[model samples]
Target chain A: MRADYLILGNSAAGVSAAEAIRATDSCGSIVIASPEPHRVYGRPLISYLLEGKTSLERIGYKNADFYERLNIEPFLGPGYDAMRLDANAHRATFSNGTEIEYGRCLIATGSIPFTPPIEGLDEAQNVTPFLTLDNALKAQELADRARAAAHAEGRESRAIVIGAGLIGLKAAEAISHSVDRVMVLELAPRILPAVLDAEGARLLQGMLARHGIECRPGVSAQKILVDGGTAHGALLTDGTEEPCDFIVAAVGVRPNTAFAVEAGATQGRGLVCGPDLQTSLPDVYAAGDVVQVRDALDGTERPLALWPNAVRQGMIAGRHMADDPLAPVFDGSFAVNAVDFFEASLLTAGLINPPDNAEGVTCDVRIDEAAGTYAKFVVRDGKLAGYILLNRPDNAGIYTWLIEHETQLDTIDPALFDSAPLNCDFDKTMRWERLHAGYPADRNEKGFLVKRECPSAS
Target chain B: MKRIYAIEAWCLGCKRCEIACKTQHSATRDTVKALTQEQPSPTSRVQVEGDRFLSLAVNCRHCAQPKCVKGCISGAMQKDPASGLVTSDPAKCVGCRTCVSMCPFGCVQVVSVEGRDIALKCDLCTEDGCIPGEPACVAACPNGALVYWESEE
Candidate 1:
């Protein structure tokens, strides 16, 4: 069968491109072939799985009936990697050895967890990397069984979490609540070194500590030594041996750009794409964690692995692939992480004082020893720049809006935050007023202005 | 009798309805105070289901053919004569989860405060006249997905 567009990868970019194509060209056949066996599920739920906060069935982006409802065929399983694009014939090959021609194709293979080279890492048993839902469920099983056994025997179930990135921190929090102890080890000098500033990481680290998770910054896992077909613990670079029942490697992910590279497409950190997310190969596009995007803050191109960014990027890529002629809206959106750790929350977006420039507003707020929260607004030239919120983020939507819309600080009163929380009654009214400025509701239609759910309410 | 309706399209899947319902029905007024207080535990009439992609904020339709009122053995659960709202009396509620079992939409919740059980649902925040007057969830919704409508309309 011949299709107008053959999309590779599934999660964010692939499904989005399919939807975009449908929105514009209804007749063209769009096939999304994914390596994953299950439906597209949110990656963040991997940690939540450990706590049994949500089940695998609930974590999926769509149910089995979603594909049929959307009028898209999801070619599931391992045949995804076998999708061979032949630009010469304008066709793709499936592992079943079936050849399908395409007018255009998109590569959104996404990324994989980067497992650093360590001694005895490959042979180690019960050493899971938090990536797919399957791995998350496996990790949960291990944690739950270990916790039960430890409680029965009156022993502490220690779980060694390697890497202090977002995933690592989340894993630590999930396990810390159920396990005897959770120790987070990071190779970098500070937690979230790439994203948050020193102060922000410190505040988060302190918050995690209070939650009973021991965080070890500036430390590296030298080796994953196992015992009795199970992960016992790890030897740190600092010459300390920590005892543990299992290990979770949250070292981050690398874009799966082998096919793109094999096709002789322009490659940077990942598959390089133009402003339209089109790769060097004609009619071929890419987006999500797999495709490298230019930073909106600074022109330096990098891969954005966050879920929201991926979804938006995929939509843009998909629209363009389907030949939407709109002059293009929204910036080449950068990566943003709005993470909720236990009771505390963190929102990091754009460049927060890049090393080259040291000129941005720095704001801090520490609630107390147990409840420490901080806010930093990285402003450049009086316009709303990057901002980070740690520990009990309130009205993050307002700050996020300011950053996204590039709203100038002069238009609003900065003192509003001083009187009440970010989502204060006054600020909420102001926000609502700004959002629905031209068209205001005349009367209370039996309830609120509209039938919408608030973020916290969700 | 005024009725409440949840428009699924506008729902962002926030459980503020549940939270507000529990808070208003609690012994104390404050959120923290409500958490610790015992008896007459608050329960929401609404239930938020679905995924991040497409969510459905579900609640009782105040059905024309109500099954819950018939399922109630102790006569505690009844359709209020004045408002047509599903009201429950804790004093008579026997802690039976029959309401929960009978609810096709799973809108009715039986909450335990200390020990005794009480039935809860959306009573239309008629008492608290905060911010003029509105249901707590409706007032709290950022997306404006839920609202009350007149039964006659």
Candidate 2:
């Protein structure tokens, strides 16, 4: 089989790239393949499903006729996943032993959970990594059974979630709806260490306690206590045992780049790609959680495993591969993440925790624990480096826009940290230009705002 | 495609657009009733910024490359290819507020109704057949501060 464009994943990056290609090359033969059996659905919404916030029907990113409207053929299911890539020969081999010749291809296989080596975890039952839809479904089923067993025996049914990262905590919160007790164990001293600082994590810990979920930091499972092939408890490294019925191992995720590496794609941290998002190979491009791009702020190469970055890279890759010579290149990305647990919401972007007392780096922060609000602004030189806002979502994007544009401090209001930002918060000229013309009208290919002489100033 | 643009010169910061926007999306669809009687009062998607001397009513630009659509984790936010209109489904939002954080214009808003949070944004005032093909915010502007028209670009 031969295809003009063959995409390897069906999640955010793959679907975005397909849309970009279909936008211009309407008649090209496009084929998308995935390891998952289900149609294209929001991968992040799987946790919301367990929490009863979303249903299967609503989780779909597009309408029912998405595939039909685009006129693309899809090879989906467990065996259809890309098994090997012969980049030199322009052929990709699938697990089902089928090879397809492609004019151009995309590697958006995303990432899988990197489960840590815990003694006897491989032989234990009801042990799964929280990454795929199947894992979420299995977790829901296990929670139901644990709930029933706890009622029958008149004891507390417990679930221990390893790795207090974003996925681990979301899994704990989602399963708490069905199970009686959920305990999160983390090797790090603070929860959500990657996104939140120690102060914010401490606040989140107190908030999670209200939902009856306990968090044990500075501890991890030394061994999985199995009884009759089922995980009954977890033996902690601190010489303590926590009784549990189900376990979610969500330690971390690594780029699924083995297939591309076997095909001799140059990799560092992840499958290295150019500014145009193309690999070293002639026609192959890499994107999503599987490729490393330069970090805009720190100027380091790392996989920005976030949804927005994946979507942006996909569009850049699609346009570049679809014969658009002047297409926009992949601008470096900084994190903009929002995680909510029940009523509490936290938004963090860029460098949340910078080096202590770095030259020309200053931090401004405000915390009102009574109202559960925390706002921190980390400024480097004259630009907005990063910020963390908790329980405040109003006009939060203004700060993000500033960070993206690297707006100077002279124009920014000092009161912005205490109140919701408004268009008036900016200088009069900027307020008029943005509200009148809209964005991307004046933005250059690299996403910087091109300054123009203000139209006679308001 | 027609888009709503704010004329900062004429905006008086009267906020009539805000009131009209809320009433149009409200359950009662009446200005007085929706404002006074509706519990958890409906929020206007358009925002009035600045003072009477210089102000603008900021609405969703619905850009060609919408960052909100790209950042939406639940796949709830989408842009209509035919009309270039960007909107989000409330049923699938899950209230993560990722869209709210990513939209540079700060037009997307989140409202909590009966303990469940969902995203609320300007759908061009096209939802529920309100004013057929017109925008209530643009229509209610007394000073002609708002205009809905196609650009020559």
Positional deviation of residue B20's Cα in model 2 after best superposition, in angstroms: 0.7
lDDT of 2 by residue, B1-153 (tens): 677878776789999999999999899998999999999899999999877576788998877778899899887888876777888888878888899889888898888976778998989987552222588999999987787766322
What ranges in model 2 sit over 4 Å off?
A438-458, B52-54, B128-132
Please, what are the lDDT tens digits per residue for candidate 1 over residues A169-216? 877877776677889999888998777888888888887888788889
How accurate locally is residue A388 in candidate 1, as Cα lDDT from 0 to 100?
68
Top-scoring candidate (DockQ): 2
Q: Which candidate is the best by lDDT?
A: 2
Off by over 4 Å in 1: A94-99, A145-154, A227-230, A327-330, A353-357, A360-371, A419-433, A437-458, B1-153
**Model 2: DockQ score:** 0.50
TM-score, structure 2 vs. true:
0.95
Worst ten in a row by lDDT for model 2 chain A = A439-448
